[model samples]
Target: MHTLAQLRAGQLAGIQRLQLSCGLTEFPPEIFDLADTLEILDLSDNALSTLPDDLPRLTRLRVIFCSANRFTVLPAVLGACPGLTMVGFKSNQIREVPAASLPPQLRWLILTDNRVEELPAAIGACTQLQKLMLAGNRLRALPPQLASCTRLELLRIAANQLEELPDWLLGMPRLSWLAYAGNPFSAADEQAADAATSIAGIPWERLQIGQKLGEGASGVIHQAVLQQTGGQQDVAIKLFKGAVTSDGLPRCEMTAFVNSGDHPNLIPVLGEVLGHPDGVHGCVMPLIDPGFGNLAGPPSLESCTRDTYPADKRFSVDELFGIACGIVSAARHLHQRGIMHGDLYGHNILHCGRGRSLLGDFGAASLFAPDGPHAAALQRLEVRAFGLLLEELMERCDLPAATQASLTALQAQCVSADVGARPSLEEAERLINSLRA
Candidate 1:
């Protein structure tokens, strides 16, 4: 949150990062002075319209964020930054993304809430590409060349105009997390289960909301009590802000949650909020048992596709088995109902110290038929995501040589390049149980 006054005074000299949101309408000349040391820059929430042509002078720059600006085109100068790897321009009016704007070293890219109807074929040249976010765009399809990004792990193409999922996308060897809920093809199918049927309407007046429990891109969760249900009982309530998130619509997420059904490792929806003066949407569920927290933090810019854990984090083989089995069970339940948990990262998982875990967050959930033609391919893509989680857990544990070998083999099977060759989550759960025995 650097101020223009501080930057001009040269007080931020030798800084590795800089952020200025003082209603900028042009690139600050003072920024060029930090070319030798600045590695990250954020100029979001401003009226900036363009970047200087010689923006490459920032030799050490590795990341840039210019979200919520007035740029109609991506600056070509970004491509000249040799070390740049992450870029974001979310919630802008940019309609054109020149081929020269994409850098070869790019990893995570965000272009959410834009009017982009197409992407350049040069996207295939970035073999190092990993996470890509293009939600809330006008894209009708993706360039087939994207399949060349075998290292890609997370993807979000929801809230677009796509008529069908790309065949190559279904075959991407590393694509794990996906969200395509708002597309015409899948949006129709997502309504298969009338949310009104699976979710009961509970009035807000019957509950007493308490302090915050947690918050995410779409809503805030809080501890609440149902006063009218015979006796007061503790529950968790999620009140949606009703915004278009990078994932998709809030109602779509609510639909997926309610229809996900009962599972040992799922935080099932017990009731849905109906009446509120402001018309805020919300849901009620059983309060989580004490002593549970997120398994990991969301991905960082440097580690674009993987979750990060604390330095002292460690899990024994038994605890790892329990965590793996719980996740596998929950996934099987979702897939059985033709639902895809698009955001399957460790950050979306909750775990107790003893290996018990639960999976939540439906913002990225998408719907398809269990017997649909694309079901197998979609499920296999999620298998790759699960494999990554297993890999992370395995790397943190000390186990016998035999046990380690077995776990590694199963993970390999899950993330196999050939989609059809990958084992189902059910099969993975079965093999994990054998390891436990």
Candidate 2:
């Protein structure tokens, strides 16, 4: 957020990052003054269309973000950066990503919400690649060469025109998080069974909304009070903001929440919201336990695929097993109900010190018949994600070698390259339960 005045006056020097949003229509040549020290540049939320040809002058530059801009093509100069590894051009008008636009060491790339109908085969050359985000685009097919990226982990390709997923999509060894909702080959758009049968509909007027609890791409969660007919009771409310989210549609999220059924480790959906002003969509949910907090933060620029936790945090072996058991049990139940909790990750999990935990957030969920051909692959895909989470938890546990050996063996089974070789969620749960005996 440094201002142009500070930069011009040399008030900012030897800084490694610079973010400006003054709506410049051209590149700021003044940036070169700190080129010797700058490692990251962010010019998002501006009217800029291109970068200077000598952008490589910043020899230490490694990450660049120009999202929400007016670029029709990825600036070719990005390819010349000696150390660049991450690039983002989200919500732009980009239609062309030249074969030469990618840097050699590129690891994470984001091109969400663009007009990209295709990706260049050159993308396969970046062997260091890990995370990729390409949601909300016109892509009909992904470059098959992407299959060569054995290290790729997190990927988002939702809201596209693909008729079918590539065969290799289910084979990536390190892949864990994946979102392909809103595509042709995906299951037909799903509608929840009559929600009234499972949960009541509460009038919005009868509830008092409070301060925001949290928010994500799909909606805002608020602490609320259910003005009961007899008295008042505390509750949680999720008021969805309509539009295409980074994941997909909010209505789809609502449908998934309503139909997810019930489980002890799942946040209870008390009812659907009714009579919202201006027809806003929402749901009534139980207030989460105050003792519970998110297990980890979302991925970072460097750890593009893994969750980040506090360095001081550590868990006992019993606590780790309890958390793992609760999550795997919930996942097995969801799979039985024909629901895919697509955004399963450490960030989406909450837990108390004693290993009491809940798996929440249905924004990336989708419906599929458990008997369908793709069902097996889908569940195994999530098993890999769970395995990664388990590995993380185990790494922080002060457990003995004998206990660690067994859990690591199970994780190895879950992340095996042969998707079909991965155990079913139910089987994985059973194995986890056995570990505690």
Candidate 3:
């Protein structure tokens, strides 16, 4: 949170990062003083509408964030920054993204909650791109040129106006995590609506709300007591914030969570919240054991799209194999019911630290017609995510030569370059179980 006063007084001369959000309406000329050292710049939560055309003067700048501002057009000068790779302009009024605005070395781009109608064909020039977030936009179609980004992985296009998923998107070899719910094509599906209504509702007055347990982009979880027919039951309540999250809408998440039925490695929703004073959307879930904890932390700035683990984090082959089995089984269960856990990351999994794991967080999950044209491709795309999870686990674990070879073999098959060539979740589960025998 660098202040304008400090920047102007030369107190922040050697700083590598700068953040000025105190109602900035224009770029401070003093910023040019740190051109040789500045690497990251954040001007979010401000009243800015434009940037200086000489922004490229910050030669070392590699990341920039200008979210929650008034920008209507992405500055073209951003493309001239030789070292800039990551850019974010979320929650702005950006309606136009000129082809020249995309950085040459771009790896990640976030444009969530914007009014973007289309992407430039020049996006193909960002062949190094890996992650793209375009949820809550007005996009009706994706350019075929996006196929040139062969290394791309995570993508979010939810709450958009797309009439159908792109055929090229289904075939992206490296694509793993994807959220496309709330689009024009799938929003009216009767199956999802039926699933949402099938779940029993628990009156809000019946809940004895307790301390907050945790929170994510879409909702907050809390310890609560539910009054039942014969007794009170301990539970965890998730009250959605009712905002367009990075993944999609809270309504979509609630629908997917309720639709995903009971599984050994999946948390089951007990019932939905009814008659809240504020009309808040929420659900009742069984309390998780206190012993359970997240397997890993969410991605950091440096990792970009991968989960981060504690420096001393380590797992034995047996433990990792057990975790793998549970996740694969849970994935199979979801796919069988036409759900795709768009976020199949370690950060979303809770483990008892002995191999037992629970997959939660349906904020990124999307439901598709089970027999739809892209069903197989969608499942396979999630397979790549699972495969990557296996890779992350393997990197932190110690395994005997033979056991390592076996698990690596299964992972290889799961992450095969040909989407069709990747083994189905059922097949992967079977192969993983074979290792135990």
Candidate 4:
């Protein structure tokens, strides 16, 4: 939130990051003063529509975010930047993405909530690309050239106009997390209606909201008390903030949560939220145990697609096995019901010190037909994610020689470069159970 006055006075020199959002309509020439040091620039929430042709003057820039702005086209000058690799232009008026606009060394790109109908095949030139966010767009198809990006790991194409997912996407060697709900091919609404019939709906009047528990990009979780005929019960209520989130629609998330079904390692949804005065969507679930905390933190800028763990975090062989078994079982349950927990990172998991784990956060989950064409491939894609999780946990665990050898073998199988060769969740669970035995 640096001010133009401070920047003009050279008060922001020698800084690696610069953010200015005081309704900027023009590129400030004073920014060149910090070109030697600025590596990240955030010009979000402004009135800007374009970038200067000399944006390459910032030779050190690596990341630039211009979300919530007025840009209708992704700046072509971005490709000329020598070191820029990360770009975010979310919530803009962007309708066109020039092939020349993509940075040569791009590793991450976000074009969410825009009017983009197609992507340049040039995106395939970015072989180092690992993550992409294109939700809330008008894309009707994905470039087949994207299959050449072997390093890609996470993808969000929710709320787009795709008639169907590309076959190449399911067979990608490195893809793990994926969300494709709210598209023309999505059956989310129908699945949600079926799931809703099996669950009770709790009226808003019966809920007594309390202190806020936490918040995420999609919704707020709060501690609340629900009045029922039997008595009053403590619960956690999640009220969605809006129709669209970075992942997809709130109702889609709500559908995933309610439909996740019963599992020891899953957060149980008690009921659907009924009758919010503002017409906001939400759901109710059992309050999580106070002793539980996140297993790990979300990825830092440097880590990109992996979760970060506490510096001193260490797990015993038993604890590691417990977490692995629980996650595999939860995943098996999800895949069995044709659900894909698109965001299955350690950060989305809650763990008690005793090894009990609970997987939450349905904001990125998607529902698919179990017997559908891509169902098998989709399950295996998630298995690669599980493999990565196992590898991370193994790094922190104190394992016996024999146990380490076994887990490492299983991890390798889970993350095999050949997607079709990866074990299904059921098989992964079996292997995990064998390890515990």
Write down the lDDT of every candidate, Cα atoms only: 0.88, 0.85, 0.91, 0.90
* lDDT ranking of the models: 3, 4, 1, 2
TM-score of each: 0.96, 0.93, 0.95, 0.96
User: Could you say which candidate leads in lDDT?
Assistant: 3
What would the per-residue lDDT of candidate 4 be over residues 266-370, giving only the tens digit for each residue?
999998889999998898999998899889988877787899998999988888988999998999899887789999899888999778999999888888889
In model 4, state the lDDT of residue 139. Answer: 95
Off by over 4 Å in 4: 188-198
Q: Residues 4-110, candidate 1, lDDT per residue (tens digit)? A: 99999999999999999999999999998999899999999999989998899899999999999998888888888889999999989888889999988999889
Off by over 4 Å in 1: 276-278
Candidate 1, residue 2: lDDT: 94
Candidates in descending TM-score order: 4, 1, 3, 2
**What lDDT score is found at residue 49 in candidate 2?**
90
Clash pairs, model 1 backbone: none
